[model samples]
Target: MRLNLRTIWKMIRELSGDDAYERYLKNFHKLHAHDEQHECDTPLSKAEFFKQWQDEKWQGIKRCC
Candidate 1:
C-alpha cells in the first residue's frame, strides 16, 4: 500500500461516510446489473440515497447511557 494523497483522501472518505453513495452504487450494480425483476431499474439519485440513508440512521431511538 502507498501513502499518497489520493489514498489518504479515500481513507478519510471511508471513515467519514463520504463515499457511501459510490460504494452503494458499486454494490447495486454488481448485484443487479442484469436483474430485471424490480419496477425501478436504476439506483437512487445521490440526494435521494443520502436522504434515505440519514433517515434510516436517525429515525429510531438512540441512547448514550
Candidate 2:
C-alpha cells in the first residue's frame, strides 16, 4: 500500500478521536526527535516509519463490525 501525506493526515485525524492518540503522538515525536539526533542522522524510510507508527497507534485497536 502506498501512503502520501494526505493518507497520513487522514489517519492522524481518525486516530486523534481516541484519548490514547495524544500519547502515541508524543511517543512518535520523541522517536522522531531521537532519530534526528545521533551521528547517523538518517531519516526513517517511509515503510519503517509507517510500520512503527501503526504498531504504536493501532496495534490494539479493534474494528467493530
Candidate 3:
C-alpha cells in the first residue's frame, strides 16, 4: 500500500485513538531495547525496524496534535 505520512497518521489516530500514539512511543522504546539487547547499534532490530520507523513518524504527528 502507498501510505503518505498524513494518511498513516490519520489511520493511527482513528484506529488506535489518541493513546495509539503513546503506544507507538512505547514501541519505539521497546525497539530501542531490542536493538540494545542484540547490540544492533541501530534504532531498531531487523524485525522491528520498519515498525519503529513508522512509530517514530507517527510520534512526530502526535506531538503536533
Tens digits of per-residue lDDT, candidate 1, 1-65, equal: 46698899999999888999999999998888676785556889999999998788787675666
Output the better candidate (1/2) by TM-score. 1
Task: Return the TM-score for each candidate structure.
Answer: 0.68, 0.32, 0.29
Candidate 3 lDDT over residue span 1-65, tens digit each: 45688788887776755545456557767777755546544334444654655566675445543
Candidate 3 backbone clash number = 0
Candidate 2's error at 65, in angstroms?
13
**Judged by lDDT against the true structure, how good is candidate 2?**
0.61
lDDT of each: 0.86, 0.61, 0.59
User: Which stretches in model 2 have alpha-carbon errors above 4 Å?
Assistant: 1-38, 59-65
For candidate 2, what is the total of clashing residue pairs?
0
Better of 1 and 2 by lDDT: 1
Clashing pairs in 1: none
Residue lDDT tens for model 2, 1-65: 45688788777776664334455556656777756545544455556665676677676757887
lDDT of 2 at 32: 74
